[model samples]
Structures are given as structure tokens and as C-alpha cells.
Target chain A: METFSVIFQLLLALSILVVLHELGHFIPARIFKIRVEKFYLFFNPWFSLFKYKKGDTEYGIGWLPLGGFVKIAGMIDESMDTDQMKQPAKPDEFRSKPAWQRLIVMIGGVIVNILLAFFLYAMIAFVWGKDYVKNEDHIHGIEVLTPTLVGDNLFQNGDKIISIEDEPLSELMQANNKMLINQAKNYTIERNGELVNITIQDEGIDYMLKKESIVFIPRVPTQIDSVMPTGIAQELGLKKGDQIQQINGMDVSMFDQFRKELTTMKENNLDSFDLVVNRNGQELAFSSRFDTTYKLGFQNVFFLTHDFKKTHISYSLGQAIPEGIALAQTTLMDYVNQFKLIFTKKEAVKKVGGFGTIARIFPTTWDWKIFWSRTAFLSVVLAFMNILPIPALDGGHVMFLIYEMISGRPPSDKFLEKAQMFGFFILLFVMLYANGNDFYRWFTGQ
Target chain B: MAYYIGVGIAVVIIAFFMAATQKARGYNFWRYFIVSIVVVAGIYMMIENLVLNPK
Candidate 1:
């Protein structure tokens, strides 16, 4: 049921985006008096799944789910209608149109994608508002994940991050993104009741990226809410209200730390471990053996039940428009920055993914707010991707059109055909590589 | 195991497409064959990835 919801949402989002994108081209082609031979929701080769002709244009859904296209007559696109190009250019053909008009037709899809992102973002903001966990609300500080950092005195457990490079952090959730995006040189944290400044080294950044390691997580105390009957914890006489103080002689004051210790013990193949728990006002020590799965069979007190101050920014419909646009702009910039990282950082390339990676972004359980937010983000990504100056893409066509306009001589039919073919090959290679990476990650459990 | 199977299927598909192109174009069969191999290899990698490691 969860998988069904995720797949359904993904397909729905793609359909909406693909239709709008093709419409972007279809509308402009009609305005320029260019004959649109076909507008498809997916690639159609031998036969289309469904198709209908309206006047001059044939609209259809293709069996192949690769992508959709607006087939403008006399254009050297993926359609590869060489016979049509061999004849004289017709009045209504795309080749007969002025360079400026052709440019508009080429860029229309990308423009619509961007506009769609902004609109979706606005609607999402208006409906759900923005909620963030303020940095101050992390009363228990953070559980530092990097063992090397602790060893090197860079960061300590239960360190409250105050600022990065003198800029105060507004939200706890955005700290990691902010740190990476800004490439912070210094971090100020409240540790052991004193403010401490830690210098971030270049090596540290590289390590984090290469390892894909999480630096820290918000700390929560490990308080046992309940123990399953006939399970390891209950069999060992562990009861509710017991606060775990340490695991296997390792001090684990927080739930995160306790879980980490458990994993470490499991990894080391330790079948038994010592546990110290604070019960009522007394500390009790016990040695326990793990079951076959190496689980304690106890549930931690629900984290959300704790009272933590959150910052909420609710916007009126009038205010949402500008805020949404701003959000879209920031999202685009962030995506562009991430794209740059792919080329600059070796590890970033491994993160490139296709449909499988995208599907995982949607929540297992259907939620309208999350669905809309993800769709908006995907729209931004689609717009940026289409605008890249790679042949066979909208950006590639624009690049050629711009060149023709500047040079005052369009490339020959033969040259355009070859370039289109080359672009198609390049795009195919990228898609494969990205999806391959997704598969590799899945198989390796990376 | 699944990855190898995927690659094998992809190679067969590429060979089939190359043969079709060879019949239509009537020359440069080897050139088309090689290009098809590269394209097929790329696509096969993606499909293999999805099949072997679906998240």
C-alpha cells in the first residue's frame, strides 16, 4: 500500500510536469505559426498507446515513459524525419520561422517549467505555511557522529551549535546544508557550559563529502517507554521508566548514542553486554545477552512527545506569492550549486540518480503537503536540467539558435542532424550513468 | 548475479538493434554496431542498477 502511494504520486507528478513542459512548446509553436506535427506525453516509436488528431496537431500518450516532446515540423529533433527535411522548407515549418521566433519556441518549455515551480511553491506555502525547529529549541544540544572530531577536539558530544563563521544559525534542521553551502571556516558551539570556537579544516569537508557522513544529530535522552513481553529486555528484567545511562561500559547519555553503541557491539559480534540504568533514584547494573537479531526489544519514549519550541512562519495568500517566488529562487540556486559540486567533487557524482532515486524522495504514506512540496522541487530541477547547454535538450536547441542568430548562417541540415544524434547519445549516456549509480547504491546498501 | 543477467540482456538487445540498423543503412554495420554497444551498455547499466538495487 505504501509503495503504491509513492509510485502513484511519482507518476502523477511526472505526468503533470511533462504535459506542462510540452504545452510550453506547443503554445509558442502555434503562436509562431509553426506546424506542430505531434505533441506527445511520452516517446512514441512504432505506435502510440493513445492518440487523437485535432486539426493539424496529433496529441497522444506514448507507451515509452522516457519523456514527452512537441514535434515541430522541419526541425532536426529526436523524431529524425529526414525525408521531410530533404524537401523544401514549407511556410508553416519550424525552419521557415525567424531566428527570434524559433528561439522563443525552443525556450518555451524551460520557461513554463520555472513558472510552474514558482506557482506550486506559492500554493504550498499558502496552504501549509513554513515550520522550522529553531536552534534554541535544541535544549539537549547535539550528539556528534564523527568519532574523529571528538578525538581531535573539534567537537564534543552534547555540543550546541550556535553559529557558523559568526552567522547565527536560525534552524537546527538546516544546519548541515548551511554549513556545506556556506563552506564555513569556523563553528561556534556551547559545550560544557562555555562557548567554544572550532576551526573547520578543508580535510574535514572532504572527509564529510567522501564518506557521506552525518556530522551530528539532535540529542534525546534514552528513556525506555516499554519492553516487549518475551523479548530480550523483558527476559533480562528491564522495565519501563528505566533510563539507560551506559551500554557495554560506554557512556551513552542520549538515545542516539545508545543506539550507536548497540550497533557497534553488534558489529563487533558481542553476544553479551553490560548495561547501567538509572531507575527511580538508584543506578542499577546488569549484564544481558542479545537475541538472534541482536535487538534489545525495548521502545524508546516517543521523541515528538517532548515539548520543543518550533518556529512557524504562516503567510497570508498575498504574502505567499512573493515568499513562494523567493523560495523557488533559493531552491534553484541551491540546485545549481549542487550541480556545480557534481563536477568539482568526485564523491558528488556518485549521488546522481534517476527515477528510482526520485521515487524514494516521496514519503511512503501519502501526504498532500509533502507531495506538492516535492513536486515543486522536482519542477525546479527539471527546469534547470532542460536549460543546460547539452544537445538534444531544450537548452541545446537554444544554444544552436543563438549561434545561428549571431553567425547569421544556420548550420546545414546534415550538420544539425549529426549534432542532434550526438546530443541524443550524450543524454542517453548520462541517464544510464545516473540510473546505474542508483542501482549500485541500492545493491551495495550505500 | 542480477547485474550480469541485465548486461547479457542489454547486449542481445543492442545486437538486435545493430542488425536492424545494418539492414536499413546497408553499410557501416560495424560503426553502428559499436555505437549501439556503447548506447546499450549505458542503458543496460541503468536498468541493471534499478533491477539489482531498487531502493
Candidate 2:
């Protein structure tokens, strides 16, 4: 059921992207009086799920779940129908168009995708505004199971996190875990008012961020607010009002200590552990086997049941447009930076994820706000991916058009065909690799 | 299999570079060799990513 829901959401998102992308071409073609043979929601090479001819255009949904297209008559694309090239070009045909017009037609999908991302982002911003958790605001300090071994010095309890790579603590966590793990950043903290500099240990940090259920800070309350069904704490016979005091014979003083001890246990076979709880003014002992699947399978009822201090700023109509445009630009820049990282940095390589990772981005429990945010983020990604100068994608066609415009001659059909074939293979390999990562994560329970 | 895919990716990337400079005469062998080296590097990285000791 979960898989189906994920697939359904993914398909919906893809379909929205495809429709807008194809419409980008279709609308432009019609405006220029060009003949559009078909408008498809997905590629329909052999067969289509449904199609209908209306006013010289056959509209349809393709069986292939890959992508969609608008077939402009007399255009050279994936459909390498050389027979059309053999015939003399007609006035309304794509081949009959001027260089500049053809350029726009070729780049139609990419432009639409970019616009869609911008629009979605703007709308989301207008509706939901923005939310962020400041690093400094985590005044309780970060709790880690593994003692942070920075260079030679080991950081212990109540060690204030001031910054990463000389950055302010507020700014350090801005880029999510990317700054702490995959990318190295220096840290400067005001520990005991004597300023100390620490280079965040990336190796262990990367593992902690990527590993499932290993939270940078846990959500469990300091006092046991409630017990959940089948939960490790509950199954071990801990009561709703019980206060956790110790784990594994260590006398834990506070909730932070309890969390710190549980988190750093890397061994796979940690089956059972002892927990001493204070219940009804009495200390009681209980032992329970931890679920090997995830490090922990408990949610804090206290935290989950209450709302955080929300800082939602609703912008005026005038403010939203500029904000949206700026947001879109920032997102586009981030995508470019990420792409460049694939070439410049080695750590960035491991961050590459396929559909499984994509699917995991969705919330376990559906929320419209989260859904739109993810969709907007993905829209930006889609725009960037399509704009890459690869043969089979929209960018590839745009590249050819640009070359033709500058060189006073179009690329040879032979070269174009070869490029298309090569592009298809590249895309295939990427899909396989990404999906393979998902499969590995699933089976290994990593 | 991923290693081979990485190799394939490298080959295509090299092919792209080779194609881009096709008009530049007399470097076909060097281009292929350079591209082959790129492919090898890519293979090494893929293996490293896949099989390297997990942190």
C-alpha cells in the first residue's frame, strides 16, 4: 500500500511536469502556425493508452511512463522519420521555419519547466511562507551517541556548537547536512568563552546523517510523557509517566545522556539492553530487544502531539512575485552548484541517488505543504536536468539548433542520430544506477 | 554491473568531447586514449563508491 501510494504520487508529479512541458511546445507551435501532429503526455512509440484526433492534432497518453512530447510536423527528433525529410518541406512544417523560430520551438519544453518551477515556488511561498530551525536555537545542545572526535581533541557534554568552518552556528546548518557531512566546513565555538576552532569530523558525520533513524537531536521528551504501542520502551514495560534514568548499567543523569548512549551503538547485533526507569517514585528495571531494522522505532508523543513555534510570514501580492523569482533563481543556482560538484568533488559522488531516494523524500504521513515543497524542489531539478547539453533531452536539441545558428549550417542527420542513441544509453545507465542504490538500501536495510 | 555502466558513461562523455573537437585535425588517437583514461578513472570511482568500507 505504501509503495502504491508513493508510485501514485510520483506518477502524478511526473504527469504534471510532462503536460506543462509538452504544452510549452504545442502552444508555441500553434502560435507560429506550425503543424503539430500529436501532443502526448508520454512517449507513444508502439502504442498509446488512449488517443484522439482533434483539429489536426492527435492528443494521447503514452504507455511508456518515461516522458511526453509534442510532435511538430517536419521536425527531426527521436522519431527519425527520414521519409519526411525526403519530401519537400511545406510552409506550416517545422523544417520550413526560420532559424530563430526553430530555436524557440526546440527549447520550448525547457523554458516551460523553468517557468513551472518558478511559478510553483512563488505560489508555495505565498501560501506557506518559509520555515527553518536555527542551529543556535537548539539551546539544549546536540546529543550524539558517538563522542565527536575532532582532529585530536574529543568534544564532550555541554560543548557548545558555535559554527562550522568559521561560519556562525545559525549559518552552518543552513545548507542542511550537506555542509556538515559531504562538504567540509570549519567550526568556531565559544566553549567556556575561550573560543575554540574545530573541523567537523566528516567521515562519521556523513554516516550519521545518511543512516536511518540516527537523528542529530532526538525528539524524545526529558520526562516520559507517554508510552506507545509495541515500542521498545513500552515493550520493555516502561510506563507512560516513567522517567528514564539509565541504560546498559550506566547511570544516565538526563534525557540527553540517555539519547547519547543509544545513538552511537554501531554494532548490528545489539539485541537487548537494560533500562532503569523511575516510576511512581521508585526505580524499576526493564530489558527489551531493539529492532534491528532501524536503530529505534519510537516516536515522541509529547513532541509529535504539540506544535512548534511556527514563523509563517504571508507576503503581500507585490512581495510574492519578487520573492518567488528570487527563490527560483537561488534554487537554479543550487542545482548548478550540485551538478558542478559531480565533477569537482569526490564526496558529492556518493550523494547521487535514484528513484528510491526520490520516493523517500515524501512524507510518511501526507501533508499538502510538504507535498508542494518537494514538488517545487523537484521541478527545479527537472528543469536543470533537461537543460543539460545531452542529445536525447531538450537541451541536446537546443545545442544542435545553436550550432546551426552560429555555423550557418545544421548538424548532419548522421551525427544527430548517433548523439540521440548515445544520449538514450546515458539516461538508461543513470536510471539503473540510481534505482540500484534504492534496491541496495532496501535489502541491506541501510 | 555499475562499474561497467560507469565505464559506459565515461566513454560517452569522452565521445562527446571527441565529437566537439572533431574539426580539430590530427588528434583522434590522443582523444581516444584520453577518453579511455577517463573511462578507467570513472570505473575506479564507481568501484570505490560501491565497495569502499562504509563509514
| Best-performing candidate as measured by DockQ | 1
- lDDT of each residue in B1-55, candidate 2, tens digit only: 9977865675665445432222121124454446545644564466557666444
> Model 2's A-chain: what TM-score?
0.78
lDDT of 1 by residue, A1-446 (tens): 98899888899899899999989999999988899877888656556789899989888887656567777888887545677889999999999999999999888888998999889899988988988778888888877665666744587767899998888887765566654554567889888888998886654446668777656667778888889887878887888889899888898878878888888888989998889999997999988788778888899875465446777889899999999899899999888877887787777777789888999999998889999889989999999999889878899889999999999999888888888888877776776678767767888888
Candidate 1 differs from the real structure by a C-alpha RMSD in angstroms, to one decimal, of: 5.5
Indicate the worst ten consecutive residues by lDDT in candidate 1 chain A. Answer: A173-182
Write model 2 residue lDDT over A145-193, tens digit each, in one string.
Answer: 4444433354444455676555565522343444443364565555566
Quality of candidate 1's docking, in CAPRI categories?
A: incorrect
Clashing pairs in 2: A164-A186, A165-A185, A165-A186, A165-A187
Interface RMSD of 2: 14.7
* CA-lDDT, candidates in order: 0.80, 0.65
